[model samples]
Target: MRTIEEIKGRCFITEDGHWLWKGALRPDGRANIYAPDYTRWQGDMRTQCGTRAVWHCMHRKPVPEGYRVFGTCTEKACCNPAHVRCASEEDFGLWMRKNGNYKGKTNRILANRAIGRKRSVFTQESIAYIQTSDKTGRALARELGVSEASVSKARRGDIVVFAGAAGGMFSGLIQRGAA
Candidate 1:
């Protein structure tokens, strides 16, 4: 088991009182630590976030159940106990909503549409046409200005919006589970 002093030694305190971790970082750029005996049941090393490990070492207790530890400072790699805080999922969500940083479903959809990342080329009329038209998938796709896969899906009633359109060509097949 590594001592607290050894773990503390791996961090360099900044003038702003941030303990910048000089250890491995997770893919999200957060600090990670490999503790050999963090859990006794496994008797093996475990990778833990640096801030959580530092909070455990300083407080001599694990973070409260149903709570997650996060850094409060601007430095993503800081592991200072004073800069770490624990919050339940609900509390964190409330805080995010209060700060207007919560990206809920409506917000995500709006953002995606604003960036032109999610625009539906298939409208109700196009879907109806795709279902009724006897043209090949490629031809239908070319006529509709969409991909062949999209045309195929529309023909097979796989597209959600157009699948239930009344009097569509594939409506009978869709009802019979044949499409």
Candidate 2:
């Protein structure tokens, strides 16, 4: 395994031969350390995707062998190496499930249901009606089979505006505002 300090400083070489100074290949075969990019902030070694290695020092795990940390340069262009953990292709499926990282029904339907099962929270038509009309919280709650509190919360912008424009009613509610 590569020493933590070595992984932390090493740079990744991209296929085009450009030096991606973000991540490094650990000697342990399990890590790809991504170096922090030059940034305006001091000691900011986080990745563009909102990940950081704060956990590494906290977890104190050694970098694995034969692993290469590549710069994801995700849309955000972050260089946080802690986001670069690895898994064998054979264990990828298990990893996703265990980490609650998959887009299955558990994340879609069941999770939505847990939030109240109101179709309005997930539909544009419902949002338009709520935003474009003078529907009361009670009325919306009745229509959507959710609690009046849910309707109020949505209207107040305390939650996502899934109702879209119908969600506009939230402004009125906020203007008149009820918690």
Candidate 3:
């Protein structure tokens, strides 16, 4: 177990009272809490976030069941105890929504597709609509809010190979059971 003094030494208190972790950072810029034995979060090989580490140190215990420790401060790397709190995922979403950060962006296209209200760039239905609309690529591009090149590539089947979950929402090449 790492000592509290060691952990504190790896961080510095900012002018605004945020404890910025001077260690590893996740891809999203959140602090990565490093501890030898404290691995395997929810059965995944992952380190805790720094804010969660600060809360654990302050409470001298693991986070309670059915609750997640989240940062209240704007600094995602902040490990200040006063800046962290435990909440259910739903409550966390509500808090983020109240703070104007959720915006229904996560899995938004999936949710919309589930509800039959697709809000993204292209679908099979849209591609069929464009193919049968008798409009030029530029006109279809304007109608679909995409580029003319995308319309042309979509027509030529050049965009299908790149159409997957993370990106490539420009054509009707998306298939189910993709990444």
Candidate 4:
């Protein structure tokens, strides 16, 4: 295992306080470190990843089981302890969702569903007919940019706000007895 002294000698601190490796870098732009004595570390097999090695060298402790170090700064090669957190991948995903870091397209759609931020693809007249129209759920969903389940829920009256447009007047169907 390379001693903390050796690792520190190969790295420099950034203006932001990150310990960046000056050695070889991986294709992903992450630091790469390898040592002949690395096998001596029972704690994560003396990681070849520069960031992980930096954490181990600084903390002088093994990473807790069921957790991996994540870069809070979004830098894969950042070795600053302050920028790293130890958490299960699942927990990290939950944190991402809560912290608005979950920007995946599907997740964005889910966020839209939760907050009613999804734009209404149906007009007032379209909403009025969603319930009585003989169109299939798939067609309605595609036309409305919603899931087939949403179309079904709207038809069942489970979604009172069936759509949003021209103000919150989506429930206009109820006033007109369109249901």
Candidate 5:
């Protein structure tokens, strides 16, 4: 059986250009199983960030010792040796929760998919209306039914806020007032 040291070579990129870390090795000199949905989360894994770190699900497991891991959130391929740590099953969960990178998923899934609860149902337009009209992202988020950060993103142009302002409305209003 091949060991992780042998798997240290690079893996092929997917059609979308995402890199996979296929070089994981087991402690007993066996080739670690590699899957397409592999997760590489970065953090201090040794302390069990909070809850039971061991995910008993069939899909996930703890990373092997001495292997460089990265945060799926940053998407940075950096393998800084100092960033690595050995985590207990519980510590890993705490780190994921406190850092808001729970389960190696991006913020989009946590918010849109509602890993814990129901998702917000506001569109960009709703956020823009709240921001411009109410002049408060927090309040607008409340009124628009989304996160304050989402409202801020809409204002900052991170997300497309459809333009609904019309010059005709101003002109018509001016004409009516004059009459």
Candidate 6:
């Protein structure tokens, strides 16, 4: 494994104290580090992110399990210990929420459902009708002003718009003859 000094040598410090990595970068632009015989379980060689290696070097220990090392600076290539911090999944979610870049899981699901509803030609009433009706796909499509493929999907529950229980919205609204 490379030493902290070797890692530092691979970066050039910016005026603002960011150590921009000059080594291999991931497709997403994060820095990558190749370490040989780094972990016993991972065999003779293992590839890791530069930030993670730097964090391990500075802290004298590996990041805790279920924790991630992230750069606090805007520069994705930076591996400066001062510019990086370790966070758990929950902590990261909280930070993302605080930064207005995240919505809670439930809220995100609800928002996505709303968006799908808006873009879809089928409504709650139509979806229930499609599921329960004995009508043919072509007939249902013509009646609902949608394509036969859509009606078929709805009948197969591929498009779920029913109310009540999990994975659905508008609870207590689906019923026989509701349409």
Give per-candidate clash totals: 0, 29, 0, 2, 20, 0
| lDDT for residue 170 in candidate 5, whole number 0-100 | 39
- What candidate 2 gets wrong by more than 4 Å, as runs, is 1-121, 161-179
lDDT per residue for candidate 4 within 44-78, as digits (tens), equals: 44347665666666666776667676667766666
What's every prediction's RMSD, in angstroms? 13.3, 15.3, 10.5, 11.0, 15.0, 12.0
Q: Tens digits of per-residue lDDT for model 2 on 47-72?
A: 32222242343334433444322333
Off by over 4 Å in 6: 36-45, 101-179
Steric clash pairs (candidate 1): none
What's the best-to-worst order under TM-score?
A: 6, 3, 1, 4, 2, 5
Worst 10 residues of 2 by lDDT: 47-56
Q: Report the candidate with higher lDDT, 3 versus 5.
A: 3
Candidate 5, residues 1-179, lDDT tens digits: the string is: 12222222443344544333344434532223332222344422232211112121122454554432333223232112223344655666677678876555655543443422223344455644654684677777776677888777777655532223222323324533532
Cα-based lDDT at residue 96, candidate 4: 82
Question: lDDT score of model 4?
Answer: 0.65
- Displacement of residue 22 (Cα, Å) in model 3 is 1.0
Q: Give residue 60's lDDT in candidate 6 (0 to 100).
A: 56
As a whole number from 0 to 100, the lDDT of residue 124 in candidate 2 is: 46
lDDT of 3 by residue, 135-155 (tens): 899999987889998788777
lDDT of 1 by residue, 1-179 (tens): 14457776888988878878888899888888765433332324567877776666665555666887777766888877778887997887776567565456665545554444225676668888999998998888887789999898888867655333233444435555743
Clashing pairs in 4: 1-37, 1-38
Q: Please name the candidate that would achieve the greatest lDDT relative to the true structure.
A: 6
TM-score between model 1 and native: 0.50
